[model samples]
Target: MTRVKISRVTKVPASEAPPASGECPPSGIRLTTDDGDAAMGLRVVGIHLENCGKQDYSVDGYPLLELMDKDLSPVQGISIVQGSGGISTGTGFDEPARPLVLKPGESALSGLMWRNTTESGPTANIPYVRVRAKQGADPVTVTPQLDLGTTGKLAVRPWTRPSK
Candidate 1:
């Protein structure tokens, strides 16, 4: 099966992620929503992944999204991975999956939140993110690749700045 890379972005101020200690799914990734405390004042309005596609794959080894700072650097974060062609509860997004085989025009949507790890300060500045799909040598059929994230339709009030 052919493997491809998937990508996405978020423009809103990311909220702190809930602890992963007892919050993950048995089979899939775990995501906790910590609507940032009053200290940082960083509120996660919403996270939108536009067009997401994965090749024919299995649910065992799905791709994971790693958030980055304004410099296109990696920011420690957690991702919500799920299967393809399914609806994710709470948020109206698609479940991310592995070896995901998509027909033409099919896509998935993944949600994410940033957690505050630094002591007494604002959270990291997250502009864009990189989602890497691990590869496995399996005979599983796959689908065509699609784009992901806020496809140029982002609006972050009071936080928007000119791109570098």
Candidate 2:
């Protein structure tokens, strides 16, 4: 018998993330993403938020995400679930969101998860995402290029402190 590797995760360090076109000012925070990973058709992209302000920054719950097309218009018919929702077990997204206060230069994380399987109808290829660290927060656009192949659902993890 032989064993073959079926999945792998690709981590893109924040220091090396490609330049994104989104910008939000006066919020004292910055949003960026990793290159993303695909494990056996399950896609995961890490969303990172850092407090770059002079004072402490706080957030609780998941980051609000609005999927957008290349034109930056909202994409319809897609569902954003809070947890894995059975999409895949053992994903880190299952953890509950807790309130976090980050000092300047500290960072927190969340993630976008989905599976691309085209069964019927058209596929969704999102070129941009409008993200808010919390409700009523200013929106910042990010280019993750989500390739949702008719899955019609995306899951998000809660904001959490990065493990030391």
Candidate 3:
């Protein structure tokens, strides 16, 4: 779904390598990814959860994706629907999840729509995505390459507080 490239994420640009910006992982939170945005076929990716570590940091729902494949393993059949369970329709990803708390440096926002459009079989170019800012929290691998042409499905949008 990234054959269009629109780009638009003002922050979350702190990187030190760890597969590509997602370093802070001692429960401090810091996952970045936003070089994604396509049009007509829908495909937006933006997952920046930054807390820099100090104290307060919480999450509510939908931030536990897997889909890895640049030698990171874990890619099986896709299908990670949470908000836009309807595939896609107006962008907001169907909208629903609410509950967050980041302090220290504060920053929270999540998203990952999909559509890619293909018609045959076999097509899920996910370069890596191991995020997990919920349910036990502690697993960030950021790098939303995801092309998912066959449309295996991947729509997550929760954890707000980033209208930039």
Candidate 4:
């Protein structure tokens, strides 16, 4: 069985400029703050999934991605909002379990919104993120050393067809 891998997970700064027309961004993951206020405790995290295996792979239901804490456990009160319903770009509003096929060397981009509820500052404990192709598949967990400041609500987007 082929296994999907997490090539890289980057923290996109709000100050980063958008891509030029018809041009793709550098990192697969994009992070943006709501209301231009990173201190206000709202962030949007985007991810690009690359297929590095020799065989093709399939993903469904938001790619089953999760932001894990230091102990490899999912944070509390984080809501996963699947991008299957056209709520975001790339993902389509079709079946809940839309099969996203990825050939070798291909990649797909997805977004997730994180909202902080607690008054605590930055989650220094969170050091890694976990991802899987689908349910029952072996999850590929990696410590990208991402600093998710404090705890909050996370709305995840599903994996979709790669844009040409």
Displacement of residue 141 (Cα, Å) in model 2 is 0.6
Query: Candidate 3 overall Cα lDDT vs. reference?
Result: 0.76
What is candidate 3's lDDT per residue for 31-141, written digit by digit as tens?
777788898887888888889889998788678877777677788888888888787677676667887878888898888988888999988888778777787766667
Which of candidates 1 and 2 reaches a greater TM-score? 2
Model 1 C-alpha RMSD vs. true structure (Å) is 17.7
lDDT of each: 0.30, 0.83, 0.76, 0.50
Q: Which candidate wins on TM-score? A: 2
Tell me the tens digit of each residue's lDDT in model 1 across 1-164: 99987675333222223223543222232222222222242222322111122323222233444445554455443233342122223332232223443332233323332223345534334544443323332111111111123221111111111123
> Where in model 1 is the C-alpha error above 4 Å?
1-62, 76-100, 114-119, 133-164
Residue 134: error of model 2 in Å?
A: 0.7
User: Candidate 4 lDDT, tens digit per residue, 92-112?
Assistant: 423354677777667665655
Worst 10 residues of 1 by lDDT: 138-147
Q: In candidate 4, where is summed lDDT lowest over 10 consecutive residues?
A: 28-37
Candidate 1: what lDDT?
A: 0.30
Q: What is the lDDT of residue 116 in candidate 2?
A: 85
List the candidate 2 regions with Cα displacement exceeding 4 Å. 1-25
Taking all chains together, each candidate's TM-score versus the true structure is 0.31, 0.83, 0.33, 0.51
> Model 2 over residues 73-139: C-alpha lDDT tens digits?
7899999999887789898889988999999889999999999878889998887787888998777
**Candidate 2 has what TM-score?**
0.83
Ranking by lDDT: 2, 3, 4, 1
Of the pair 2 and 3, which is ahead by lDDT?
Answer: 2
Error (Å) of candidate 2 at residue 131 is: 0.4
